[model samples]
Target: MKNVLVTGFDPFGGESVNPALEAVKCLAHLKTETYAVEVREMPTVFGKALDCLYAAIEQVKPDLVICVGQAGGRPQMTVERVAINVNDARIPDNEGNQPIDTPVVPGGPVGYWSTLPIKAIVQELNRQGVPAAVSHTAGTFVCNHVFYGLMHYIAESKAAIRGGFIHIPYLPEQAARQPGQPSMALETIVKGLKIAIDVAVELEEDIVTMGGQIS
Candidate 1:
């Protein structure tokens, strides 16, 4: 069976939990007749997240990699369209590393578009009644850090390992602490991720659709 690795981050920013990890834990070792999924928890630090990601890539030698993270205010599992080649941290990472306006790779490309069928993933998730959308920015934090690193690694190594990043909203409990912030149930996030993975594995060509924002 073809192997696919799903990675998620550990808790950071003074939060006791990360929805990404929670979803990853729920998705471990998911298998079908055609492909399999292996899950790993990456550090929330800048350099170390990439290290853990690369190590997992080496270990799994997956055909696809989906990196998941928490986006506190969003109510949907937003499939990121691109990862920029910068790291500008608004706050320190888990290990207290704060990088500002630094290239993820010193001379790398400005950005990398996700190789997965992003539009298709969003379509599938919404069709299932799980909220989702195409996100234009992964942000310059650790999530973007790893996203860029993964793309750089894929480009440099000349590997056929298709990669992408997905951002999930906070869990209900996380949002409960801060009123007016939207959140999705953990099970909803898991279901959306499963659909995304399936679409990534099965659909090589992304569907043509409108997922644009004027503002």
Candidate 2:
């Protein structure tokens, strides 16, 4: 069976819980005939997040890696298409570090495309009655840092691993605290993540779909 490693960040921004980590914690040892899933919790800090991810990758030796992060205002699960090498944090991280326009890896490439079948995962999630879409950006926070670091590690080490990042909406409880914010139920988020994993494992290439933004 193919080994799959999924990661989520710890709660940041002073919230009680992080839906991404909670959902991943619920998916331990989720195994099927084709693939087996292992979960890891990454720090919300920029540099340390990548360090944790690299350790997890070494320990799990997974064929595929999906890193999930919380995107509070997003209404649906978004499979990121790219990870840029910039680190421009809008706010301080959990450790109170705020980087302004620093490259994630100095002198590295500008960006890295996700190796996973992003469109296929989005299509499958929508087919399963889950809200999902293809996202072009993973943001310039710790999420993007880890994503770019993972792709760079794969490229530099020549590892046979397909990796990508997914952003999930805030939980209902998290939204309850901030009025007028959109959120999705935990069950729905977990369902969407499982569907994404299944589709990513089954499909080799992304399907041709019109998933673009006008803005």
Q: State candidate 2's TM-score.
A: 0.98
Clashing pairs in 1: none
User: Given candidate 2, what's the lDDT at residue 205?
Assistant: 84
Model 2 scores worst on lDDT over the 10 consecutive residues at: 200-209
Query: Which stretches of candidate 2 lie above 4 Å from their native place?
Result: none
lDDT of 2: 0.94
Q: Which lDDT values do the candidates have, in the order given?
A: 0.94, 0.94
What would you estimate as the lDDT of candidate 1?
0.94
Write model 1 residue lDDT over 1-215, tens digit each, in one string.
Answer: 77899999999999999999999999998999889999999999999899999999999999999999999988789999999999999999988899998999999999999999999999999999999999999999999999999989999999989999999999999999989999999999999999999899999899999998998
